[model samples]
Structure formats: structure tokens, C-alpha cells
Target: MPPALNIVPFVSVDHMMRLVLAVGIERFLTELAGFIEEDFRRWSAFDKTPRIASHSPDGVIELMPTSDGTTYGFKYVNGHPKNVRAGRQTVAAFGVLADVGNGYPMLLTEMTILTALRTAATSALAGKYLAPPGARTMALIGNGAQAEFQALAFRALVGVDRLRLYDIDPAATEKCVRNLAGLGFDLRRCASVAAAVEGAEIVTTVTADRQNATILTDNLVGAGLHINGVGGDCPGKTELHPDVLLRCAIFVEYAPQSRIEGEIQQLPPDHPVTELWEVITGRAPGRRDAGQTTLFDSVGFAVEDFSALRYVREKLRTHPFYADLDLLADPDEPRDLFGMLLRAGAGPGRD
Candidate 1:
């Protein structure tokens, strides 16, 4: 049965967890990546722009939006490194998918978990095309809330099982290790970023800080290694050094957005970069040689959120993981909104 015009499907956090658990996390990520890749292949068909962000001393809040003609979507997300100190999540989000014809919302869901999944999925999807072939070892820096998701997504999509983990706080690293235990990964907790990247073919720098910080220096980055820069997602928040960007053939989700928010923000405005969609679609090259250093400066994009919301909307068809929310006002006569409000106040037998 379909929902009423006034109703929209809402997937709550608990429902989202149940959905992922039911489908299996790795399988969910693998499937979600497929949707993202499908959308990227037709990348030229959608509207694109840099996410709208309002920055503050405490953190940043952003609105990411996109559309592919028939459908439209948007996500509301925030990043506050200090939120964790107050027993809150450092990143939190929610999103909506709507019908373009009527401008009516079709689906609404919490995106905090979804964003983590999509971000990891996007990272691993890039790894599929940009990471060194047969790369099995991955150095995962910044073992925070997103660490385990990134680890799992890589294993599912990129075939990485060996993980070298590190974080500024040892407790966060321990949490990641504990969560990933018995997950068939060869886990090593390294004391430093250099140690974590040592002998690894793919190094992911995902530290959570709002200021310019060098988590990966040029010397630590070796030839032929794929660097997934996940933390440098805002104007001042960066994880890789300028020298590292100069050394690698950089790939990004969207160039305009990445220039403002990705690791490439450190370089000159005219510095060259290949969008990941071009590489995935074979319009551009990725990892030309074995010794080439490739960087996927993954600042989360709106198309990814669009793909994720649509994926969840599709899953809701087979799985009962969502509830119908009365989100729209459907007056009896469409134009009689005030009459509808009057009827509600009239109580029983009002009509």
C-alpha cells in the first residue's frame, strides 16, 4: 500500500539500525556503494554545487542538496568537535527525499548513521578505482565514530582486511579495536601516524579537528600508496600537508566544493584535480602507474546523500523499517486549508 499524499515515510535511528542489521552492515555498504556508483556514472545529469555552510567558533553546520530532474534531495548536517565533550556526537544529520513534480516529500530519515555509512561507502568506492590494485593493508588514522564504518566499507568494497589504527586519544583507538574484534581483520594499534602508515598501501587520515592540523606529512606518504583524506572537510579543518597534495594526483567528489573544503584547499586555486566521477566513468585516468601517489580528497557530497536516501527508500519497499509521518497538510479541497483547520476545532461530527 502506498502512503497518503499527506504522509511521508520516516526512518528513525532505531529503524535504520534494524534495517542495517537485517541486511548486514557490509552488504548494506556494498549495496549503497553500488547506488552511488550508478549515480556517478550519470554525473552530468544532476545539478551540483558546494554545500551551503554556516561556520562558527564552535563548529560548522551545512546543507547539502542535489537533484536529477525527476527527484530532489537534501541533507542537514553539522560538525562540532566539542560536542563529544558534552556526551554528544561530533557529527549529526538527517535528510529528505522529495518528488519534483509536486514538490512533496516522499521520504524523511535520520542521516547521522546514514552519513557515516555513505561517507565510508564513498571513500571505499573511490578506493575501488583509485587505490593500488591488490591493496590489502590500510592505515586508518582517527579511530573515532566513523573509524569502524570506514574499516568495514573498505573490507566490503576494496578487499582490505589488514587495518593499522591510530588516534590522538588512545581510548578512541581502543574503542575502534574493540568494536572490530573478531571481524576477520588483522588489527594493529599504532602509537603514531607514521607507524600506522608504515608498510600500508592505503592510508586514510580521518582525524576530527576544526583547525589546520597535519595528520599526514609528505615524508610519511610513500609512492604508489592511495591516501583517503577524510578529515579536511571545512575551510580550516585539514589533515594532510600541502606537500602531500602537491605529491599526489588528487581526486575529489566535486572540484568547486573540494577547493573550499578539502585537502586541496591548501594549494593554489588553479591547481589541477580530477573529479572522482570522471575516473569512475572512465572519462579520466586514475592511478596511472604503480609508483604514483593518488589522493581522494573526499569531502562528503550531496549526490551521495541523494543516493543514500533513495537506497533507503527502496529498501523500505521490502522491509517495514519506516513509519508514515503526517508531514503535509492535505485539506479536503486543497485550497481550503483554513476550512480544514476549522473542522479540526469543531471536534466530533465537525464535517
Candidate 2:
């Protein structure tokens, strides 16, 4: 007789916390950046799709699904900008990893923190190629839950040592400054977005507002600066002025999706923008001159989530405390999937 089948791993939030604590956030960001860069280098090997979005009156829910040839993954994330006022996280997320061959779920874990980490990692990865060498200072607009992660990622990857923070809500800026007080960064709470962007090498906009507000206007951007636009990821949600995009050499993760959701949405459909992979692969140029402006209009692609899922799966092997769940029913025979359901008496109209 064959041995009993094994149960799949269910990584709870606590299990993920252990993994993150053991690895440390900076190291995880470094590794995640490398994974994302590798995937972008082999961009054609994976199945990609624009995230499926469900818009409600107050917020939006998105499902990002992707797969390499062997592994598959998906993340369910909701963005409710107003939730923070009610003491809830503005973004909450969870994800699953599976084997493409058998379609069996291998792992499941919360992605709220993971999403913050990966978004920062992806931004820093683009900055590595797009920002000027020896870039040190960054202006952070919309200091909220993601501000700390973005600051840390830039500090670790792009050598950002000073951060100028700004938000319409002073409490949000205060919270961000408090979180980074002991993190070895020189933090300055600016009076306005212009003050924050002044003299900064990289400007990162991660606002939570779901409207079309301009955080950075054309007159505010300086030459040779790299812009990480993270807030305007949905239609009617924009952070940069239209002229700012017009003046800069724009780059994005995926073209088709970015054209609709990224800051480039304000530009014409025929407006020329380079894909980040092209710069990574040496197919296109980044920052042509010291005086040229560059923008990375980030919409948080599925491939980045894919990379994050893969990283967590690898980390789970080192820490065994993650719960094991049976999300998929497995039988001794691979072709007897329906048979197992029949044996369990879970057919139509039977509960």
C-alpha cells in the first residue's frame, strides 16, 4: 500500500512574521529585487495579465494572477484609502502559490506587509537602473504605511541617507517620522510637497488618495532626478502633473497595463515610454544626461507579486512553523480528482 498523502503548507501571518524577522526586511528586499530583476530579464517566460479590479464606492479590490512555466500564483488585495481613518490598514492582501503541473496549492500567506515590501523593492530596483549613480537623498510624498518600507528599500539599495517627508495630514508624516527615528536616517518633516522635493535626488510619491490630485507639478522637478510614482496606480488616481510626465523620460514595469493605470495614462496612447526591462537588458537607455529627468511610473505588476510569492515559499523551507492546510484535495491517483470529491460526498446540491 502507498503512504498517506502530504498536506499543503498554509503560512499564516505569524508564520510569515517569523520568516521576515529571521531574514530581516532589508535582506528580504535585496533578495526580492534580485528575483524581480531576474524575472524581468527573462520577461517572455511567464504568463502575464493585467490585474482584475473590482471597484466599489469607497475602494477597489484587485486580483493579480501570474505563472511561470512551472509555478503559478495569485494575490487578492484591496485598497480602501479611507480605512486608515477607521484604524484599519488601507491595503490588505493575501496570496497563494501552486504547482502548475498538478494545480495543487503549495502555500498560502497574508500579503499586506509583503505587498508593501515588494512595492518598495520594485521601485528601488528601477531606481538602481534609472537613478543617477551615488544618489543619496529622497523626497517622500504621502507618508503613510508604505513610507517606512520605501525609505528602507532606498536606504539599502540606492544609498539614500536623507529623507524629506510630506503629507497633507500632519499625523501621517509624524507617524512616518516616528517609525524611522531609530533607523539611521536623517528625517525632515517638510511643510509642503515642493519643500520635500527641493534638492532631492529621487522623489517618491506614494499617496493614498483615490482622486486625481497632482503631488508634483512640472516646475517642481529638477534635472537628473528619478521619480518613483507609486500612488497613481488606478484610473483617476494621479500624482504627477501631465507636464511633468511630458518633460521626463518615462519607464514602467509593463507597457499595456501602465498605459492605462500609470502616470502615462495622462499622455497620449502613442507617447513613447521605455519598459524597465529594456533598460535592465541594455535594450534602451536610462537617464541620457545629467540634466535629463526620468520617471518610473509604477503600477505594481503581477510579476513582482510572483517574485514575492517565490521568495516567501523559499523562506518557508527554512522555518517549519507555518501551518499546513489542505486547500486542494489530493488522491493517490493523479487522474482521480473527481473521484476523491465523490468519495467525500461534496457533489452538487449536497453539503
**Most accurate candidate by TM-score:** 1
User: lDDT per residue, candidate 1, 1-351, as tens digits?
Assistant: 744789889999999999999999999999999999999999998999668889888888999989999999999999888998899998999999999998999999999999999999999999999998999999999998889999999999999999999999999999999999999999999999999999999999888887899999889999999999998988888999899999999999999989988999999999999999999999999999999999999999999999999999999888889988989999869989999998888868733
Candidate 2 off by > 4 Å:
1-6, 331-351
Cα-based lDDT at residue 113, candidate 1: 97
- Output the number of the lDDT-best candidate: 1
TM-score of 2: 0.93
lDDT (0 to 1) per candidate: 0.94, 0.89
Candidate 1 similarity to native, TM-score: 0.97
lDDT tens digits by residue: candidate 2, 137-209: 9999999888999999998899998999999999999999998999899999999998999889999999977
Clashes of each: 0, 0
Q: What is the TM-score of each candidate against the true structure?
A: 0.97, 0.93
Off by over 4 Å in 1: 1-3, 349-351
